[model samples]
Target: MKSLKLDYLKSLKWADYLFFALVEPRRLSGKIADAASKPLGGGIAIALCAVFSDILAASLLAVNTRFFYYKITYGFLLLSIIAFVKVLVTAGLIDMLCQFMGYPGAVRTMIVLILYSLFPQMFLLPLAYVFKVISFAPPFFYVLFSIALFVWSALIVITGISETHSVPFSKASLMFIFPYAFITLTGFLASLLALASVFGYFASI
Candidate 1:
């Protein structure tokens, strides 16, 4: 049987291209130029990484909450499941945007790009939380981290979309807004429904 790592490497080596995803996103455009030909392993890797990232973040927050720090309330398993579902929903939302915009990209391509772009948030969350615990940090520190993470993720996605779709940067930015809003709304509604279900279950019990 062929290995997933070998499968991923068939498209692009993770060790090398991950740097491009970090410092030079434009480099990934050519690597995935033909989405149909690219190995699905890349997308799988991103999804798994994203799920584990969320779980790791949840674990760190679980410990930090006890220290009177970031108060996250989900257990690792729940958070991991939520992360998996979230990636699917967000990828679907991006596909919707692509359909509306008449962009000629596959849904798989969108999913891969979106998750790849979010790689930084996955890697940084634990470090940021640990750093804050090690030293007293002001609100500004978190604000800065949030902004940096947003810009970093946004730029990578925007760059990917622009280069892959041949869309102009300004238009790409506008195109991204719809999926972003959809993702945010989807998460919000999911949260409210979950809360309502919990309350209803409590009332029944």
Candidate 2:
């Protein structure tokens, strides 16, 4: 455990990683991919911090509500667990897709890139607190900013994939989006089938 902690601390160059991720994701991804011998300590740390920031930001929005304490406690735990699982699963799926496409990149590298991409979400906590204290802009500011942050992260991931796989930005975007699009379509079709079966049963009854 002590040795593991040392390794994690040594690899946790959070400032440099965050800077490169913001300005030059392609370069950052390359660095991460090259460091294959290192443990995934940096990636795991960043992912945890990012999830915590997002959950805390969301909880801050409920400050005026009676459930603020509840959200701060159990909501953070549940949401953090979900976010952690989502990061791992999504990384696995993306790496599998890359392998099937003949890229054969490491799943660990994918996880690192994905976690770095989520660095923008860390800003949400400050933004939420600022808005809560000032209310300078309209409510739509939150929606717009949220969408912008999402796009920022997506672009980072796309760029990272392009850098890792030596593909064009357009192809990289397709690679990043394909898994999610397929999942959404599958879920939609399944829901439609479920509804149809229910209606058929009601009609028979």
Candidate 3:
């Protein structure tokens, strides 16, 4: 058990993977692939990091609030809702699929890859909107950056999936597709709830 535990520890590198997620994504891919055949916590750690990053970005973007405390509190609450919903739906649904296909623990690899694949988005919004890093830059530049981040995230996701499993590309793409479909379903449900609340409020009045 000690030897196995030590090997698991060797496969896990939450900090290093997070850092290289952007600069050295190919290197990050190797780390993820290495963990595929091992029972490691790297994926779980990275997923949690992504959640924290979302909350941070939301809080930072709330800078317009006159008071720092309320800004952070409300921002974290707002982003937490979205992040948890996405995370839960993605993990649950994908894990189910993986299990169906005889890749049960592949969820660990999936979550890490998904988080790092989305690192660009999670990293960029805070820098651009919150810190005002590229505030002086032209609007077109921001748009271009967003596009690049999205494309890069997509490419990295594909590579990560390919490395983690021997599953065909078509099956692997389902991992991406399911999360997006869940997001759309979630949004639709939210809108319906909002509409119902609005109507109920007017009826009560």
Candidate 4:
């Protein structure tokens, strides 16, 4: 029983993973790649924790006068389901992009790496509360802090992709960005086309 407990404790080194993911991402990426064949429970747990932090931060920001337990509970459940789906879809998109870029990687590896990259986002919850406590804290500072966290997470994911795909960091970075860039460009062009169609119809009238 004692041995089992020790092993269990050793297995839950998520804290260390989070630390290294933020500070030593390239090294942590190698470790994550090595453990990619293991059960996905740990990676899922990390993703859930990161997602919960984001939800909790938004909940804190939404609190105006009173704190309602049921609202948070229901919101968490609904948002968690949405977030999980988004992660899976994103992993698929990223994997497809990687393959298109000639750096084919496993979907499972992408999922694990993405989840580990989110480790830095877990701090957003506490930072939100801190900003809330300080009445004079500027909104600019909060925005900067949020942007910094996102950039940090992006770098970690980029590094993981480079390590796992055995590709140049530049290529990995482009691979990491291609999906979102493509989506944004598509959306922009679609909006412009819709606007032009509307104008053409009005002109015909």
Candidate 5:
């Protein structure tokens, strides 16, 4: 009976370890560890980092175009820089957020959650362009850029989640996709309304 009790205690301890392992900073650290062990995984992480950088660049371009009225050529250059920085920052943030979530690691388990939360805007960019609502940059570039962003986010999430959760890529991919779609829809609608208000204000002027 005492042996049985000891075994149960051991099992409980293992379960606790596994549960906390899935949570945050530790999870990110685990991914880093896995990547170090596997060359292919390291390569994937690098690619994912680049993708995130591009998304950041595109987002910066959009904002600059809207508020600063920067020339297109200059805006593109700025976007490129932003994208590079974004990937670096995002990776770090993922690490931090993971730690906050009780997971520690460089693998970035929440990358999927972030991407899934943001990707829907890709669909909205074209519609916003077609409507001729805003005088900002071209719609096609934004949409294309957004696609790249989505891809990066998806990759990061997939790699991170698979490493941290020991889940298959196929399953984690779904978690990235659906939530992003919903968030994108919400953001698109909000953008449409804001654009409409801007147009109305301009016409009144």
Candidate 6:
């Protein structure tokens, strides 16, 4: 047990550990790119699915309230479950991407990326709750979080594309936003179109 603990400490010092922690989305994107022959639609679908799933999971968990009301668990259970679902979906998405992109060891990479990316958002949740500022908190927080993940993912993909893909991090970050921007725009347009169609149908009725 002592040796195991020592080894664990030693492993923490490795650069790969830091790399995986700081830039996990890149690793995830690599996996996704590898998995799908055509990544754009599949990537968007996977992301949207994960986001909706997380929202649903959080909503259901929030409704339980037993621990919050009686046991006085202080948000531990809620935060824990939220983190678990986030990590699960993140890992699954990464694995699917890697498989699509034709990368080797997609499953292993997904596990590593998920483990590394797990805790940051958990930390964010309590901070947000404590601050109690939804106006300044929710919208930009998730947008920036998604952007950061996508930036890392894009960096990994670009780096993998060429030995000399040496764009600055800021530029790469902007590029990463492209997919998300498109997704947002398209989603908005689709919603508008759907609303129009519904209103038109009602008018005819």
Q: On residues 59-146, what C-alpha lDDT tens digit does candidate 5 reach at each position?
A: 5446544533443446546654564455445545545544555654543434323323233333444444543345555556566656
lDDT by residue (16-119, candidate 1, tens digit) is: 44676788877765566654465345555665665565545445534444532222334544655665566666657756777777877466665667667766
Question: lDDT: which candidate is best?
Answer: 2
Q: Per-residue lDDT for 1-205 in model 3, tens only?
A: 9997677568764567767667666567678767546323544444445456645544444444566565357755665566556655675677676676677466656556666666666555555553345555534444565677778777667656655665666776776577678779989999999999999999999
Off by over 4 Å in 3: 1-15, 23-30, 33-63, 101-105, 125-147, 168-171, 182-205
Model 6 agreement with the true structure over 1-205: per-residue lDDT tens digits: 9997579557763334335434554544354334433223323333334344334334333545444343233344454456556545544554454445454434433433434343233333443343334445554555565456545544543333221123455543443344456557888999999999999999999
Indicate whether candidate 4 or candidate 5 has the larger lDDT. 4
Candidate 5, position 25, lDDT: 26
> In order, what lDDT does every prediction score?
0.65, 0.78, 0.62, 0.75, 0.48, 0.45
Query: Where's the lowest-lDDT run of ten residues in candidate 3?
Result: 38-47
TM-score of each: 0.66, 0.85, 0.57, 0.78, 0.33, 0.38
Instruction: Please give the ranking of all candidate structures by lDDT, highest first, separated by commas.
Output: 2, 4, 1, 3, 5, 6
Model 1: CA > 4 A from native = 2-12, 35-39, 50-74, 125-130, 138-143, 183-205
True-structure RMSD, every candidate: 6.2, 2.6, 5.9, 3.6, 16.1, 10.1
Q: Compared with the true structure, what per-residue lDDT tens digits does model 4 show for residues 31-136?
A: 7667735436666777777777876666666644445465467766776677678677767888998787677568887777777777787788788778877854
Give stretches of model 5 more than 4 Å off. 1-77, 84-156, 178-183, 199-205
Cα miss at 177, model 6 (Å)?
1.0
Superposition TM-score, candidate 1 onto the true structure = 0.66
**Candidate 3 TM-score to native:** 0.57
Which ranges of candidate 2 are over 4 A from the true structure?
1-14
TM-score of predicted structure 6: 0.38
**Candidate no. 5 TM-score:** 0.33
Off by over 4 Å in 4: 1-6, 10-14, 63-71, 189-205
